[model samples]
Target: MEGLLTAETLYLALGMLACGAVAGVLAGLLGVGGGIVIVPVLYTTLGFLNIDPDIQMHIAVGTSLATIIPTSISSSRAHHKRGAVDFSLIKIWAISIVIGAIIGIAVAGQVKSPTLTAVFAVIALIVALNMLTNPNGKAIWQSLPDKLVAQPIAAAVGGFSVLMGIGGGTLSVPILTLFNFPIHRAVGTAALFGLLISLPGTIGFIYNGWGHPSLPAASLGYVNLIGLALISPVTMLFAPLGAKIAHSISKKALRIAFGIFLLLTSIRMFSGKLF
Candidate 1:
């Protein structure tokens, strides 16, 4: 254990813990899965650690999902206690997300790091813009056609989850809200969707990276076990605190801050590879 605490390892651990704490709080408060906060941090920190650039995105996404598993569970439970979760919706979407995650993970493994980075950057930009334009539950409960609308959304959530290393909350919450669901209910359901996304996403990363010699130490495919182990507990512990904070702040302010964070991270990611 002491040996594991190299200067680089310790730095990464501290970073992970801090990130987890922040993410956990936000997850609890905003009903987002916290992956948006986790992925860029992981990518940047892992790059700084001198891990191979070729697999950096894979590692970042996989590890992010790994952390999400526990974090989502804790977050969902908290929301469930408050009667926010919609069980029926979750049951409808889980199957599609699971299948989509499997396929997405497989595709992600075959893609190059540069491509993945670019993709992530674009996604970050889109999220930032969306947050800036619409920052609340105003779009919730808008009413859409029944099963026809849900299937594609569920599949898309799964694909994006694997690609972005998120629990689908970023997409799920907004969509659910658009369909006229309450903001709290949408958030809670998104948390449940995260479970479906992470399980298959984690497995896919492991399976895709199996027997790949270039993988870093303590890696199961693109997923970094060391990073996940160090960060998850911290994230789980602090998520409720974030939720409390969320309740205290205006949704618009929170969304704006989160948007700026994503934009800056996305720019940094783009610049890192370019320079």
Candidate 2:
């Protein structure tokens, strides 16, 4: 315990707190709950700490999902209070999402770091394109699929979200809005999906990663307790603020901003892997 109190660790803790704050705001604002921000940051942080490259991306992704749990809950509640969340949709999609999340964990555990990186880059690019094309919240499609059709899509969202270390918002919001759901409502509903995806995903990663080598101190499998402790509270504190702002903003402006964010993030992640 004493050894963990070093200045370097303290700086890392501060960095985690900063990341958490940003993630919380993004969770509330974009229904993404910071997993998008958390994964790459954790990957870099772990590398700086000299954790092995072989498992660093896995640890980063697992830890990001762990952090998303509380962030998503807080953001969802804020959105729910605004009457923006669709609980009925959540009920319909929950089971399928959980199943997908479990499948994602299995796949992630078997894959290599570069493979995971490439997957993230591709997903991010696709999502960015989707957002870029629909900045006004216009429905590209007439309606969302019925429950039967939606189940598989929901599962895919869950699986992909788990694999990418994101809340399902990056995919879910775009899909929902393309089906004519209001952007704010889609964002709100996506927050719930994030929770559903992260909880099971985090548990699966922890179990799968148990006894693995090169994990940082205080890590439970790939989930780092120190990171969670430092990040969760800060995220909870700021999420509501983001929700308030999201509600007040113009949808067109917000959509454009979020699209640009996704584009930049995708490019950064892709560059890291490619270059």
Candidate 3:
């Protein structure tokens, strides 16, 4: 325990600060929980601490979701003020998404780090391709599918996002746009989805990882307290700024820039699968 405390050095603190800053902006601007950024950073940080490779991805994913809780709140509120959030959709998708999240936790516990990383890479690639395309262009459909069909998709988004250590915005935003939602509205609604995906995700991870022998100091299951404390505050501070940028900026530029970032991130995630 003493050595674990000693390992919480300046390097970890600085790394988390920088990670948080970028992640915060991405959260608000991209309507994501910023897990694409958080997962990798936390993974690397834990590696530097000599954490068990078997559990590193689990901790990173859990911590990333934990941090997303507040960031989604901040980002969603900002979008709501702009009339971009759809409360009806929120009500419709809430239950199924939460159920999916719980199932995701169960699945994650059975997988190793490589499998989780692979899933993240593949999904990130898909999202990057969607973003690079004309995200706000003509839609395939006139409106969302009926609730019976849509609920299952919502469940999948929640579960898949848990595997990727995300807030579900990366998946939800694209899905919403496919159903003819405006870009801003999709982004806003996805911000709420982040909350739904993350709250249960964090709890499930903690519960699943309880009494794990490999966790770091100040860990609650797979969630790292120090990392959460260091990251969430800055993300909250910047999420509103990101939301402001999202509303004010040109959609095209946002799409292209975010697309490129995800493309690179996906590639990197793919390359890091062995670790």
**Which candidate number maximizes lDDT?**
3
Listed per model in order, the count of residue pairs whose N, CA or C atoms clash below 3 Å is 11, 1, 0
The digit string of per-residue lDDT tens for model 2 on 1-275 reads 67766877788888999999988999999998788888888877877878988888888888889888998999999999999999899999999999999999999989977787778878888888877787788887898889999999999999999998888999898888889888999999999899999998899889878998777889999888888899889988999988999999999988887888878777888777421
lDDT of 1 by residue, 131-174 (tens): 77777646644575477667877898788778888888877766
Q: What overall lDDT, based on C-alpha atoms, would model 2 receive against the true structure?
A: 0.87
Per-candidate Cα RMSD to the true structure, in Å, reads 2.8, 2.3, 2.6
TM-score of each: 0.90, 0.95, 0.94
Lowest-lDDT window of 10 residues in candidate 2? 266-275
The lDDT values for all models are 0.78, 0.87, 0.88
Ranking by lDDT: 3, 2, 1
Candidate 2 vs 3: which has more TM-score: 2
> How does candidate 1 score on lDDT?
0.78
After superposition, the stretches of candidate 1 with alpha carbons farther than 4 Å from their true spots are 1-5, 273-275
Q: For model 3, how does the per-residue alpha-carbon lDDT over 176-246 read when each residue is reduced to its tens digit? A: 87788888888888899999999989998898789999989999999999999999999999998989999
Between candidates 1 and 2, which one is better according to lDDT?
2
User: What local lDDT does model 3 show for residue 82?
Assistant: 92
Candidate 3 global TM-score: 0.94
Off by over 4 Å in 3: 1-8, 273-275
